[model samples]
Target: MIDGLDPEYLDACPAPNLAAMAQRGFRVNGNGMTPSVTNVNNVSLVTGSYPETHGITSNYLLDRQLGEEFYMESAEFLRAETMFQRATACGLRSLLVTAKDKLRRLLSDGATVSISSEDPPGWVVSGVGEPPPIYSLEVNRWVLDAGRYAMSQEPFDLVYLTTTDYAMHTYAPNDPESARHVTLLDEGLGAVLEQAPGARMLVTADHGMSDKTRMLHLPAELGRYGISARAIPVIKDRYVVHHSNLGGSIYVHLDESSDLNAALDTLRNLDGVEDAVSGEEAAARFHLMQERVGDIFVLADPSTVFGDPSEVAMPAGLRSHGSAHETTVPIFGCGPGLDTSTAARFRQNLDVGRYVFEDVLPPRPDGLLS
Candidate 1:
């Protein structure tokens, strides 16, 4: 699910932390698109589609064509349905939490969700009858304890954590700080592994990070074409664009309405555009859009990226997934029911979550499957 972690990176890994996991579990070679923003990539993992079909191209969504201006950050927006909800309808319990609150919402509708944005809240509980997935704002000791409890609880089916994502965002993925963060989270994961040794466990990053010195200005590029990109100034380094008034994915909204090819041509032709293609191209190569993402996409070369760095200040000496830069990430798993077949074939981020104990998530039940 990362770009640069090719065979070369693997050859250099003399450490025991990840190589041992690779030997025991499995490893794959794949490339996440440039602008490998988390929300879009995570949604792709769950829904098995590029942003066009999944409809979450970025954390912040804006569509001028239909007069739609709102936080398209909720997981509920996943093609108006999500895999987490689908899993519950089929009788599996699910737990989701992430700094990307939107993913939790989309994937945990019918299932139980414990989520937080800036913090993982400690005091939210509703387990009996169905309840809107739990959302908390602060990270505390309770979350750690509850995570342990969930790991041991037989009835618990799925559990997700976002604390690491926040830390990775604050600290570069290659940094020692990020490794320390992974260690802390690993303790909790190890607890789960020990308790549910029979259960399937898969670990992966939403996307990898490439250090960036310049954040490419997306709106300014769009503005040059006389299109005002409204969502440019979002605090994070991600951006979203689409047409207003549509139930379709972002690509449909953008392609059908705007001179997308022309817009893309403008984007591709730009001096900074390292690489450009439709989200379709990204989907095919990255295994991203089973549904759709966009007809066009741009994966900036190291020289150019996809945000207005001037608009927001990146953490001091921290740059990971949010830039338009390119980076590589790996997926790890060793659990029950996993297919040991050809583990070396590459896969995208979402493919990691697809099978629980070697069982492919049942086909989505919501009528949207049509």
Candidate 2:
């Protein structure tokens, strides 16, 4: 999975390798889960399911009893079996190489070989050498390098490679920096193809990126309507340098004295607001975990992002996701036993995993014993 990779950006950028894959195999637009957050879709991609099944509906989770927390980096938040764990159960060795250590831990289950570009001293394996600096733009390249090294040392029946979205979050699709990073990513895929000649490879993203300029201070906005609400951006991370916690989706938990319908009406009238719904409606409509969502859910228009104004000021020119606008991403693959004949029938990001396990490999003699 490539983080924050938008299909629109693919058209603007030059990725000859990916373009070649389209010619040799198939490519189609895949729908990410509603609210289009990272943690939700990554779990979906691994489980061949949606947030409702995997129970990860947002990048930042809020449990009323435990307060709010970033959900993107934790495997404990995942409620379903990962493809790696499933493959391992079927007697297939699995390898997961990721740009972030968080994903390494999240995808690692059932003794799978897991390595990260963000590794510390003793965390990495022997053959898959140390990675480059995590903050560098070359971090994604570092992940691919580790994958190539690991593949050379031994063979695995299943391999998962995921990259960071630092470039996609900070640069426009046609910008020099973004182009350079994408070209490097494409070249890395070419190298992977060389190492595993007959391997079935599927490339997809957790969510797409959007250019959001205007910022809405949601808490303060709710205050104007005599509503006490905690407006939490659904997208947040420890690495705030890129997005500064501003995103297009916000979960609003109303205070005990506040009127829910009044706050929803006020939010719906706000400029740049796309849609606002009650928690129950949100869960049913978006397939979210009802208990984890707030009293009200807000989606910002494509040009705007929501954040707490009290947050340290955001730097100029940064892009972000975690919105309804970033739902469609490019999904494509090539190799023996990989079927693209039904490409037109493709739907959600979960289909990528379903295709790999069900079509590319031998089905479990009976049912998956998960």
Q: How many backbone clashes does every candidate have?
A: 17, 0
Best by lDDT: 2
Q: Per-residue lDDT tens digits of candidate 1, residues 1-370? A: 2212223333433334444456667766554433455566666665555555666655554444455645555645667345566667667777665443455554556666555433345433332112122221123223443555544544666666543233333444455654454454445456656777777666665555444444556556667786543322212322121101111012322424467667767766777566556656766654453333345545555533345445444333434443334335566677554334635433755565444422646654554451
Predicted structure 1, TM vs. truth: 0.69
Over 4 Å off in model 2, which ranges? Answer: 68-72, 120-130, 360-369
Candidate 2, lDDT over the whole model? 0.80
Candidate 1 Cα misplacement greater than 4 A, ranges: 1-20, 33-35, 117-145, 218-269, 276-296, 308-310, 313-327, 339-346, 357-370
Q: In candidate 1, what residue range of length 10 has the lowest lDDT sum?
A: 240-249
CA error at residue 106 for candidate 1, angstroms:
3.4
CA error at residue 341 for candidate 1, angstroms:
2.6
Q: Per-candidate RMSD vs. true structure? A: 7.2, 2.2
